[model samples]
Target: MAKETKNFVLRLDAQTMEAIEKWAEDEFRSVNGQILYILCEALKKSKRLPKTKNEPTKSNT
Candidate 1:
């Protein structure tokens, strides 16, 4: 399956950039990958992402 992605420019302060770089390195992912991971997690936490077939469903007992 092909996933579509959009490219955009982001500006960060020097300290913020340094922090993100360190975090990315620790996670063994590129800065962009780390950013994307964080964004997806936030979306999931906020229930903003639509349900997908591959995602497991939770049952209420």
Candidate 2:
């Protein structure tokens, strides 16, 4: 099966971009992939990702 992909444009400072590039190289992934992987992991860790259709409602005081 073929893998799906998407494109996006992200802005960062030169130093931060450089660091991400280096990390991507170390992990044998493209910079974009590394960034996505990191964000997915972070969201999973924080339990704020993969949102459901119905979010909880706030009580009206």
Candidate 3:
């Protein structure tokens, strides 16, 4: 089955938006994709996102 995603509106300052746009371009990703990537990284760092069955653990390979 496909994963479900929730959508919400986000607001940011013009300067911050421009910085994100540049960072996204540098990383060869869309602005939205970059934001999602950053959020996912933060969640992982904080241990808020649990590992899924499909993901390989450090000892698996």
Candidate 4:
């Protein structure tokens, strides 16, 4: 099954948008994908991203 996503409006200044656009292009990702990647990374860094059953937990060697 595919994950469901919600849509909403976000407001950003021109400079910020431009920067994101450039970063997205450099990484070969659409702006939306880039934004999602960034958000997921932030969540993971803060240990706030919920883990799905299928996701494997990191094991210390």
Candidate 5:
């Protein structure tokens, strides 16, 4: 599959940047990937994530 991605500038203080670096290293993900994964997971868990562009979502009765 082709990669789905968008580039956006985000502002973070030094400490937050440091933390993200450490966490990304610990989780074996690049910093950008870690942030994207985290946001995706959060949206999924919150039921705010949509089905894939090609997939239909079933509504609960």
Candidate 6:
């Protein structure tokens, strides 16, 4: 099954939005895609992203 996504309004300063637009253009991604990528990376860095069913759990030695 495909995952469901929620949509909501996001307010951003003009400077921040401009930066994101430039970044997204360089990376060939839409603003929404760029935002999702950033959020996923941050979650992974914080070890807060949930493990998918296909991922194996780590074993402590």
Top lDDT hit: 3
Q: Which 10 residues in a row give candidate 1 its minimum summed lDDT?
A: 52-61
Query: In model 2, what are the clashing residue pairs, if there are any?
Result: none
Evaluation by TM-score, superior candidate among 1 and 6: 6
Candidate 5 vs 6: which has more TM-score: 6
Q: What lDDT would each prediction earn against the true structure?
A: 0.91, 0.86, 0.96, 0.93, 0.87, 0.93
Q: How close to the true structure is residue 60 of candidate 6, measured as C-alpha lDDT?
A: 30
For candidate 2, report its TM-score. Answer: 0.67
**Candidate 6, superposed: residue stretches over 4 Å from native:** none
Task: For model 6, state the Cα shift of residue 12 in Å.
Answer: 0.2
* CA lDDT, candidate 3, residue 56: 86
Give the TM-score comparing model 4 with the true structure, all chains together.
Answer: 0.85
Task: Put the candidates in TM-score order, highest first.
Answer: 6, 4, 1, 3, 5, 2
Q: What is the lDDT of candidate 6?
A: 0.93
Residue pairs in clash, model 4: none
**TM-score against truth, every candidate:** 0.83, 0.67, 0.81, 0.85, 0.75, 0.88
Candidate 2 per-residue lDDT over residues 1-61, each given as its tens digit: 9959877788999999999999999999998889999998899789889654575545532
Clashes of each: 0, 0, 0, 0, 0, 0
User: RMSD, model 1, all Cα superposed?
Assistant: 2.2
Please, what are the lDDT tens digits per residue for candidate 6 over residues 24-55?
Answer: 99999999999999999999899899987776
Mark the regions of model 3 whose C-alpha exceeds 4 Å error after superposition. Answer: 56-61
Clash pairs for candidate 3: none
> lDDT, candidate 6, residue 23?
96
Across residues 8-41, which tens digit of lDDT does each residue of candidate 5 receive? Answer: 8999999998998999999999999888888999
Instruction: Report RMSD for candidate 6.
Output: 1.8
lDDT, candidate 5, at 53? 63
lDDT of each residue in 1-61, candidate 4, tens digit only: 9989999999999999999999999999999999999999999999899987777878722
Residue 29 displacement (Å), model 5: 0.6
